[model samples]
Target: MDPRFLGIPELTTEAPSVAVVVDVMRACTVAAWAFARGAERIVLTGTLDEALALKARHPDWAALKDGPPAPGFDLVNSPGQLRSADLGGRTVVQKTTAGTVGALAVRDASLVLCAGFVVAEATARVLRERAPDEVTYVVTGEDGRADEDLACAQYIAGRAAGGSPDPAGYLRRAAASRAAAELTQGVRRGSHPDDVALCLELDRFPFAMVAAEEDALLVLRRYDGNP
Candidate 1:
């Protein structure tokens, strides 16, 4: 069970048996948390217009952007705030800088899973059960390659292969990564201290977020990784 890890979503070439879309900075992480909190389903979009359009069509679904809270959106792209959100039986429409877009782009993957440190172990557990011959960890970056996303891919793949990489070390490296610096400079939600830590909290969630296509849109659902 060898798994390939690629940095930058645009560079993904193969349609692996399984594609793990990793966005450690915030997007995928918060989605996992949302599902665990009882959100019915989440629609992920790469473009803000698509997200807005989806929300418009489905007024019941909450809408949010990738960064800070803005007008007409139900939430911001902050894990810190999502941890306390009332997501019970509700659906959310989200547009992130990368994760959702990457998941949608990889149409060849038989199984598309969104993951972060919070669900890393559980995701590994689920992947091991599926045991696809080819797996690609697609790390989404805001602009180019992001160290934090790369670290997340390494951790997820390592855990799935029964190898334990240094979690503390990975966190340390990510904290000082170019992605972190850029987020801070850009004043994005990833810049918040709590938001960063929330994304880095390894294995905090017991379920992996799986994407299923419905009406040509990917909606996320929680899959219990443990028996």
Candidate 2:
């Protein structure tokens, strides 16, 4: 299958057989890890209020919104933030800067998969098994263009197409990009250099995260095989 990596806020009804949303720094990264570690299901919200409202209705679920740590959330949208949380049996309600928004925006996709380097190989396997005629990888940059997201898109698309994609080389490019500069320079709102480092780890997991809507809530589940 030929995979096309393109920017967000733009996907077509004639898009592709599958749409893989990439946000390496680090909304999708956090989502993949959250599911891998045994969170019941993650509900992706488009805003903080929506996430909070869901949490209010389902008090047992964990919430991760766009801003700072809220009143009753087990975690936030940072991969580093999720590392120490005990989310063994909880549900996570997440609203991020880009990844979740991109997931919801692409109504044209036959299948939507949330992606990062953590699940690139498995994602490729899933896409390969399905063998879609065309696959579109949406580089869901944080509010705008993000170097990390674009790099991950390249890595995942290259791997899915049976090529040796250099994630390390892409990582170098991301590190030198404007987004990284903002994070390191405190020009960006919700990130630090640690966040930059967290998202750069390539292909960190063995499974792909397939996004499916269950009961109107977009949930990302771990799929070790074909979607």
Candidate 3:
């Protein structure tokens, strides 16, 4: 059957045959890197305090916390930082404004896969192979509302189920936004432009990491790589 889309609230009762959680702004991208770098697991939490608590309790596990700036934490939801860190044989606990929360919201799915624009093709290929009875794409939004998440959902939904995505249009808009931002005026002018460029590379990592509650973290690795 074709894959379907559902918001987080809709996930309360209806258990998805397979659910893919997306936070394209950064979280899922970082998770992908963590998996690539040999991270055993990643615990995704909604609050920084919860992540910190997890870290304190499990000192053996390498904990990395991320969220909005106002309420600070160990990290600031940047994929660059995650890539730079050596996560070999470590378990990262992530807290983000939207991504990790979205993962937690889809607590009822039989199988959950983390996704983002970076791994969109990989995600669709996995869905096609699994061909689950039903598929739900959950887009975790900032401030508990949909915008980029929904746009990304629409893009993936079209691809996974045999439709079309306006890739050019989307790229144009994204480029326009970046062009509009006068970064030179900012305090940190030359900060990590390569990082943003790296995040835009589609399907750089040939994997889809799934969250495992047995260890309360994502099990890193590839999903089959067959598209």
Candidate 4:
């Protein structure tokens, strides 16, 4: 069957056999890098309080939390933060408004894979291999309506179904809007610009992360084979 697309806000009800969580503006991308750098487990939460509570409980493990500046978390949902410190043996707990919440909503999925532009190819490979009865691409957004997330979702769905999507078109539109937002808001955002570049970087990583509910953490590695 062809893959299906769903906005992150719709995930709570329209569950699919396999759900791909897209947080292109950097939560999922950063998580992918955390695994690459040898992070043991990543706890994804929707709120700062939840992440901080987890961190307070697990003091031995290193924790990193990110969200909008107003909420005042440890990180700011930028992939740049992932490179700041070595997380060689730590467990990173992440909290974001859209990404983490979107992920948690589909906890019952047979297969749950985190996705972003950076790991699009890896995500597609995993979907092709699993060949689930149905595939749902969930795009997490800031206000249930972010252009970049929708563009990335469409790109992934198009690619997995043997169809072509205009990656440049989506990137151009998203990039221009983000650049404009930066100038007007003076927010000096890091995730969107870098994320737009990162998402377009195809197959830079060989593996994808799969969430294991029993373990409450992502199981990092490559999909075994193509379906």
Q: Against the true structure, whose lDDT is highest? A: 1
After superposition, which runs of candidate 1 have C-alpha atoms over 4 Å from their true positions? 8-14, 142-144, 182-186, 189-191
Ranking by lDDT: 1, 2, 4, 3
TM-scores for candidates 1 onward, in order: 0.90, 0.90, 0.77, 0.81
Q: What tens-digit string does per-residue lDDT give for candidate 2 at 1-227?
A: 77777777566656566899987767888887787678867788777788888889989888886546668665766776677677888889888878888887763467888887777788888877787888888888844367777777777777777888656798788778776677678675545447667666666788788777788777777777776
Error in Å for residue 190 of model 1? 8.1
Report every candidate's CA lDDT: 0.78, 0.76, 0.62, 0.66
lDDT of 4 by residue, 1-227 (tens): 46666776566575578888777666777787777667777777666776677777887655555534443344555665565657777777777667777788787788888876667767777776666667877777754466767677777777777666767886665555553355235364434345445544655677667765746543333342441
Which runs in model 2 stand beyond 4 Å of their true positions? Answer: 13-15, 142-144, 186-193
What is the Å distance of residue 122 in model 2 from its true position? 1.7
Kindly indicate the candidate among 1 and 2 with the higher lDDT: 1
Clashing pairs in 2: none
| Candidate 3 lDDT, 95-143, residue by residue in tens | 7656777777765567778886677777777777777767777866543
Winner by TM-score between candidate 4 and candidate 2 = 2
> Candidate 4 regions off by >4 Å?
12-14, 67-75, 164-166, 177-196, 215-227
Any residue pairs clashing in model 4, and if so which?
117-199, 118-199
Q: Give per-candidate clash totals.
A: 0, 0, 2, 2
